[model samples]
Target: MSPLPGPRARGHRLPMVTALLLALVGTLGLTGCASLGTAAKYDGGRLRIDGTDLSFRLPEGWERRDNEELADALAGSEIDDELAERGGISSSQQDAILDEVVLFAVGPGGSSLNVLTSSEALPPRAVLIDQVESFGGTDVRETDFPTDVGDSFAVAYRLDAQGVQADLLAMVIDTGDRLSVITVTTGSRAETDRVAEVIRTSLALR
Candidate 1:
């Protein structure tokens, strides 16, 4: 309209167009960031074991496996049929039910501990300590039966059970209705000691 818009005016219009495109891009980026920030929430402590929600703090960089796989690894000479008969279930069902029994003993240098509900009355704390010591190949460094935390005890030790050597530690927490035993076995003395501390620090019910 005014002098038909000279070349200089056209160049100015191009810059304005570029500015508008930049603004649109910026707006889109902000929207994306906001969406990502407002994503769903989850309880980090809850782990899915055999489709069951079991709460525990997962150690960093450790891998998780199913019960069947673990049972196969720690099977020994135990017959699947015999195990199932005790629980009135098939081998496959028993595998699913006991999936959480075996946990990470420590990859490479770790051993496995099978957790089970105390079937024949609650065994003495000394019995557990002795079993762990015998299996771990280490003496019990410390044991404390805290009355406050479900009358459970924390046991620390160094073990060299079988060919695999490790620093083993466990928290035997029994809540009358349920008993949870968290055991950590390290590959080397140093790694075992480090993980033992981590397990102790990360120990919690919820």
Candidate 2:
């Protein structure tokens, strides 16, 4: 060969090619890592519901609506009117209808509540738990109630409704003076847990 193409020319070209390849590899690796991390955080199409800082990841193509307006509209309504307006169906036809559901924490008492209108009244806790277990595809977990709030309890369950299954967790805190409840509903158990965890972590007994 003619001086092996000259060391100066070959060496410079080789190092530049090597550096470009390394940079490309690094870029690809970073992109893959980011994708994996997002997938890991996704948690099967769920969203977290924090107090005021509600944050969670929803499933692709799923529509989410905030009912803050409805909450404000329905606040302090007697149960009958509340149910009627919420269901938007004749009382007789309310059976098994999965109406728009509302989850809210009332006050310092931390008594979580879920309000839904159905033709038939929901069963008691035991029966509700059984129904939830059947639909949620997971065992129900009961959490300890605060001692200060006697006879109040908190429970979390998974639910399948409207072709989508999600996690619904509620905390019922009843202080004799007042009742406060906090509830979080999410598209997945993981999302529900994340929201509930954040609420629990940031809870202030005002």
Which candidate wins on TM-score? 1
Compose the digit string of candidate 1's lDDT tens values, residues 1-206. 46763221111221212212211211222222211112122334444322222244445654444434445532442344433433345656645554435342223323322233321223355665555443323567655445443556656665332233345455565554445555555444466556545554554444
Candidate 2 local lDDT, 1-206, one digit each (tens)? 45543222211222212212211211222222211111122233434333322222333322333335223333343432423333344433322221234332221111122332111221234543443343333547876544432335656765432234445665544333323334555555576565556545444433
What TM-score would each prediction reach against the true structure?
0.50, 0.38
Q: Candidate 2, which ten residues in sequence have the lowest lDDT sum? A: 30-39
Off by over 4 Å in 2: 1-68, 71-138, 145-152
Task: For residue 147, give model 2's deviation from the true position in Å.
Answer: 7.9
Q: Model 1 TM-score?
A: 0.50
